[model samples]
Target: MTFSHDPVEEVARALAASGLLLRGGFSLGEDEAAPAGLSGAPARSILLIGQAGPAPWPHFQRWRERQARDIANPLDSWSREVIGAVAKEFGARAVSPSDRPYLPFQQWAMRAEGLKPSPLGILMHPTYGLWHAYRGALLFENGLGLAEPHAAIHLCDTCVAKPCLKSCPVDAYSGQGFAHEICLGHVRGPHGATCRTAGCLDRNACPYGTNYRYPADVQAFHMAAFAGL
Candidate 1:
């Protein structure tokens, strides 16, 4: 199955300009959740696309500056626009994490990248930590023959301190689950400036991947959106 060009390299090149990296992908199994491709047939492979940290911030900001105020889900919209273009170029279908009746992205992510959820319920990467995200995926009718994903040590398992749980001002996360109202209210309130400007105290406390952590401005943008502010 020789080709004129390497599909993976070509796809990666298309997304690199937008600060989206190919997070790795997998060939769909017969029993796995199969999303329809552009041709409306079940897709055979999926290449996850996302940012490691603040890589997409500049691109997103450029796009945002041109938009009217109060645009809904600006980041998601940007992701779709960027990823959709790459998908169209490759004759693939694009899907986002925010898609309704959402595909099992988390499930697929763990399978594709050997990630597991942290105490904060965000997928914890050994190197990228919680700072990374799965923005969108390109679903193809034929396999791209991507390399197999490798397993890594789950950082949460060995961390005895577990600072992520204790740093939240309102104790928003717990064994029970995230306290949405409590967390939202605090971020939107006056005293929430620390979190609003810096980012989730809990997520920031995870010492595993501090090198890849998001900057304050990037965190502020997401926090503002989360608080509807």
Candidate 2:
């Protein structure tokens, strides 16, 4: 159809219509930050929202253990389709970091963009908690709008005890960053600690966007993958 329209508005409206919430706007410049496939996107605006919940949500600890369900659904179908469309619109393909070839690309996405890796990569967010997840994106030619990322007001910043760093009996998260191997052992090894009991201490400790925590099963599944189970 080749419909001519304001690129940003088109994306915004489309996102809104798809039932994805607009949380905040962020930009990854030529080198500062770029996703796995964003090298090909056209110039377009960035939209941010929690997808379902309003801002100023609760803290992570507030979500109790028994409250979660066993069924796992991350990012929701609507969210996935919307993100896929956005990536395609930008002339790039959305690739999950789990894809072997894209592993380096995923690492680059984090190193280049300052995103920390968590067990949550495979999990999705509901209310921006477990129902939310990021699809490593690449852009071909599309120009993403200049917008600020979701406020760093998330939990990582204000943690006092830093349970994420301390909770892991294996010390998976050293002062520098995630200790991938150690984490794998604890979750996958016969000697591995009971992940279900300890839970994701790091994620659970974070204070920011608590309302965006992943549903329980999703969190466990992601942890298991990181553990290589």
TM-score, per-candidate, Cα-based: 0.95, 0.53
lDDT of 2 at 144: 51
Residue lDDT tens for model 2, 1-229: 1326754466556555544443344455665544444545432323332333321113212322324544233333334445677656644454544445554543443333334444434222222432344433333344455444332223333446655556566777675666777777666766555575345666565544466565555566556645544
What digit string (tens of lDDT, one per residue) describes model 1 on residues 156-187?
99999999999998999999999999999899
lDDT of 1: 0.90
Q: Which parts of model 2 are misplaced by more than 4 Å?
A: 1-6, 12-82, 85-132, 138-157, 190-198
Candidate 2 achieves a global lDDT of 0.46
Cα lDDT, all candidates: 0.90, 0.46
Count of clashing residue pairs in every prediction: 0, 49
Instruction: Flag regions of model 1 displaced more than 4 Å.
Output: 1-3
Model 2 lowest lDDT segment of ten: 54-63
Q: Which numbered prediction scores highest in lDDT against the true structure?
A: 1
